[model samples]
Target chain A: MKRLRTFIALAAVPLVLAGCGDLSNSSMSTNSGSSKSGSTQLTGQSTDSDYEGVIQSGHYQVSKSRGVTNTQDSGNTYNLKSFENGMLNVSKKVFSTKKYVFQEGQYLSSTTVQNWLDRKSKSNTTGLNPTDNGSKSASKRNPIYIQALEEQDYMTQKNNKLSLGGVTIGIAVNSVDYYKKTQYGATYETKITQAAGEAYAKKAANTVLKRLRQKSALKNVPIVIAVYRQASNDSLVGGNFLAYSTNKAGSTSVSKWTPLNVKNYTFPLSSGQSSPNSNDASSFSNFKSQVENFFPNLSGVTAQAQYDGKSLAGMHVNITTQFYSQTEIISFTQYLQTTAQKYLPSGVPIDITVSSTDGIQSFLSRTKNEKKFTSHVFNSY
Target chain B: MKRLRTFIALAAVPLVLAGCGDLSNSSMSTNSGSSKSGSTQLTGQSTDSDYEGVIQSGHYQVSKSRGVTNTQDSGNTYNLKSFENGMLNVSKKVFSTKKYVFQEGQYLSSTTVQNWLDRKSKSNTTGLNPTDNGSKSASKRNPIYIQALEEQDYMTQKNNKLSLGGVTIGIAVNSVDYYKKTQYGATYETKITQAAGEAYAKKAANTVLKRLRQKSALKNVPIVIAVYRQASNDSLVGGNFLAYSTNKAGSTSVSKWTPLNVKNYTFPLSSGQSSPNSNDASSFSNFKSQVENFFPNLSGVTAQAQYDGKSLAGMHVNITTQFYSQTEIISFTQYLQTTAQKYLPSGVPIDITVSSTDGIQSFLSRTKNEKKFTSHVFNSY
Candidate 1:
């Protein structure tokens, strides 16, 4: 009967874990690592019991207890918490829950981060030392994981050990939600004004810090909360809200947050749109590969991400091909748009130019919209 | 070994029958109806022996005897002939073979005509009177089959009794062949002057008549040899020479050929293209279905075939839908072109107009060419 109960819990794990898009079974396999003495460790015990208000802020709720992280051992006990802040009225809202572990690298692949988290969890649960697991070194476990959430809680888990020395919290306040009434259906408005939304974000960050101080195991971890904000709904990731972190001394130093930027982040486009330094080539390589797979006739693809120096403005793609048929050109362009939307920062303009055989050229431009939106096409043969 | 040989032949029958595209075993099952007391009957013997040169004209060869029409029955000895007229210089040439049978209906569906042939062959082989079989009537057996030949000698078989009372031949001269040389590849020049090609078509028609007269069975059958000439390579079917029949007097009267266009069959297009009274709504219904299948969102379709007083000229299609994407417009238009090309006359222009939502209009016009040709697109949005 207990074995059957374990099977049922395992079957329901995926559904519970799906709330956060990252905690996939294949990626979150707990790493068997050697343990070291003198470090405080905690293990999560999945429970069928629901716990509310574990992590709650303003209009957000992140700590919904789901039995996905449960183990076969019934004697184990685990504490979980989730916090959110966003919409007050509406059927939909965006809540981001961040689990900061001291790790290396500004940006780490999800698999790597999940490996670290797995190692950390395995070490605590099995009483095994991570150093004993020769597959990965301890130095690789000290990195930051930043996730952007919208419409749904798309948080996923990656495992790595927190540095015994300390923990750094990277805080990013994403897009703000607004209400709009339409005949078709009610929809959420994107970032309206940062000044109006920043107050909520700052208070949420402070609440997170206060909650962390209450935890005995995390009371001394150095906190680095870097807040990010979107200028408008259509803008991609917003500019940084001046980098601020807790002093090396202890959690007591997390009292004050300061702006890290020399000036307010803003880069204006010729079209009068503004954003941050969004031209991250490495970030868009995967998207380019997807485009190439869709259109094999493309001899070459050159893509540049647009930024206002504070947020992502849009993306521009120039392609060279031998195809001269207008239908083929249009089909290829639309396919590129469809694929880009899946991997790019939402609400940014996607501009593409196709140069084909016989000096034929075509341009397709589209952007996310509000008061006035226009999609334009230009062709020369 | 005998069973194996029979199995092998049956296995290969489908492969051999696929060249003409319409002679599927399932659809061509002969229906037997009551047989009348007296008619000059000749049975076909599906023999392993191949007899060549039954029909020959100019450099084109349609008389390449295939043993598929041979019979195993010794009493059955059906004589077949096919005369072709085209070119010998180019790698690709259009050759047309017309088999005039003493029957009813100037126009008959290919499948119906094939069923009659299959019935005639089966009756001759099994010695079963068609009337005794109670499947089809004698009236169904008396229809003339006209087949257009192109790249290859795409001709099958048919049989009927020659009316001893008298013979009438329907002559329709199809599109003429033109030639042009370009860097990409050599393309045919369209009809430039009918006078130059009509002489050749007339000679070819005389050759066919001469061949028919030489046959003992067909000697009494009145022959109508059509001579068609195209204005341009893109023209569907060409101008008709005329209808001529054997004199009621005898075979001696078959010498003179006359023009059948007493009123000059003229159906002028809005764009000034002249054609015959060609409103084949039923023939293009299947093609319309294909179009609808290609574009599910299509609201309506309008298609018309343009026929020269004698043969087909081209086709025009107008479509209405609520398409907002340019890719959809191109895909639908391309599908239309591909489907139309399979049924419409070669080299003829296909003009399509698509009316989409938001008052957007797309026009695609294309014509087959030799070396280098251009397709044009005009959009009003």
Candidate 2:
């Protein structure tokens, strides 16, 4: 129940550095400041594309260039400093995709996890006969990939009871790697044929299902197995995947398995759109780059998007950075919104949660239209 | 942003009656009774098709005929008495959909709102030209239809900025009616050609857009207008709707309007598998019926389901009753989940919230494969 209450944060990162800054804003004021009289009514005439139109009476002026400015008589102020800083450094990091395999492994060293598995195998050989024992545990080394994939709770719950009903299990067909080493850790080696990968993923998934069925609650849960064909060093998030489900005589026990149509399990923000089995890794990388470009000092960042079939439903982008002032956070949030509006197909709400290197966390949420913002600074750090 | 923090409850029903119940359970026990010695090892051999399998060591026993039975050494118990009561009288006021014109009137009566509009027109007259001024204050009679349509905040926000950037606005091609009167109070006679309905919905929607654009904050918001054809007195929840968007040259003002594919804006529980413009309404209705069937005294019920394009993202069901015991609530929740799993697409999280006529609110939530449930009861009535 606690888990249900706590919606998953966008990303998880290790503690790397510590920075300090208070969220105080000294410029907040309620007085309606009088704009400079006789100012030119730039009204749609400005050549600068960043021209943020003219401010109406009793409202704050939007700065074309960027800095905090209180143009309204009320306390409302337009802070563009963060936006300007981000724009100035827009080209610093161009978005790019990286190849990696999407699979589950605790983010332990490959040697460590393999050892753990060996020990478990020696102690209890009742289940978990890993067919792809031939393949190395390479995915364990990439913490981001591990976190992204493992966090998905594949089954659906009915009547308050958790079941594997209708969940399509995914298996990796071929070994994929992002690089020799990820920012989090080094990669392990893995190589398997497409047929072997399918056999391995399905077998691995069934092993999991078997364990679940042992429990009284999950015995009757329905599930499916899907195999994905991954190119060597391909992005783990996106790819064409095949689904296999059991043919039941009367919704009883399995009566052999049949292959379903090629279903796509896309990673969020990927460009592949809706391929039969794969996601475009390049699109997500570009999205990440664009996000990092807006922060003043981006340390490390992990962004995740959610898709319903091929339709992108929502996204959670967590940015890790050095100390950011309150104004900087606001500005960064605005910048992120502008970018999403430009790139993301509309109506998708994006949750931008920022965690400082020191562990301080803040959440900025935006939904299209209906001008209102929900944000909170967590001080537990 | 503050609005984002407050997720909408399933319904906003007016008080129709009052009910009462106490949250007491005299059946709390922590003893694990040993099974009868030499009992048949039902362990997987009972071919009784209704076999629910064995009970887990620390879990409760499941009754195939539906009754609460505790079989765990731990304090877990199967509270099925409530379930049985619910199933006994499943025909108690089944949740159904009502239809009304999807016009904006602040959910007030048509005549009252129109009169209000007339006053504003006489005093301000800056905008708001009422083309169809012949109708009186009739819509106020239909509260259910009004609440059903007005509560949808479909578009996501960027930061705190609400825009229609990617929301495909759905418009009904034919003016639909629920009956002679609606919950909010309306009885308007409408008979228009399909072309006329299209023209009216569009002009009305555009008028709304024009009014919104008058505000500086909403000037740059992007929106698409979708229209759907509905038979007179049809359910407003599901059906294929059409879409129309302007071809803006530079995200400024509308350049020219273009008709888009008939996009669907389905109400909960309708059917039209994943499509650009349809939803599965029947499934949701059945889910609702199954839920109501479990509750002893069900009053008014309002349920809503959300979809990302065609993929179901989540659902919110609010029920009003006289009173309920904790066990009864649990039974109802379990029934709801079971129905959802059987009917809904896998992995779509469902949020079931309940409100009692006595002014008590409870929320129970579950995600796939996650055994624990999140529930809290609040007495804010």
Please provide TM-scores computed only on chain A for all of the candidate models, following their numbering. Answer: 0.33, 0.38
**Model 2 TM-score relative to the real fold:** 0.26
For model 1, the docking class works out as incorrect
DockQ scores of the candidates: 0.01, 0.01
Residue-by-residue lDDT tens digits, candidate 1, A116-167: 2232354344211122323222233321121221111122222322233333
**Per-residue lDDT of model 1, residues B121-215, tens digit only:** 54344211122333222232321111121111112233221223222222222232222343566544323244434444454445445544665
Judge candidate 1 at residue A288 and give its lDDT: 59
What DockQ does predicted model 1 obtain?
0.01
Instruction: Please write out the lDDT profile of model 2 over residues B1-381, one tens digit for every residue.
Output: 111210111011111111211112212222223223221111111111111111122111222211001111011111111111111111111111010001111112233223322322455453232333433444432111110111011123233222233222233333443334347665554444566555655565565455445546445534444434443443323333334454221243344555433222333423444433233466656545544433334445555454445565544556676432222333333334334455444465555556654333445455554433333332100
TM-score of each: 0.23, 0.26
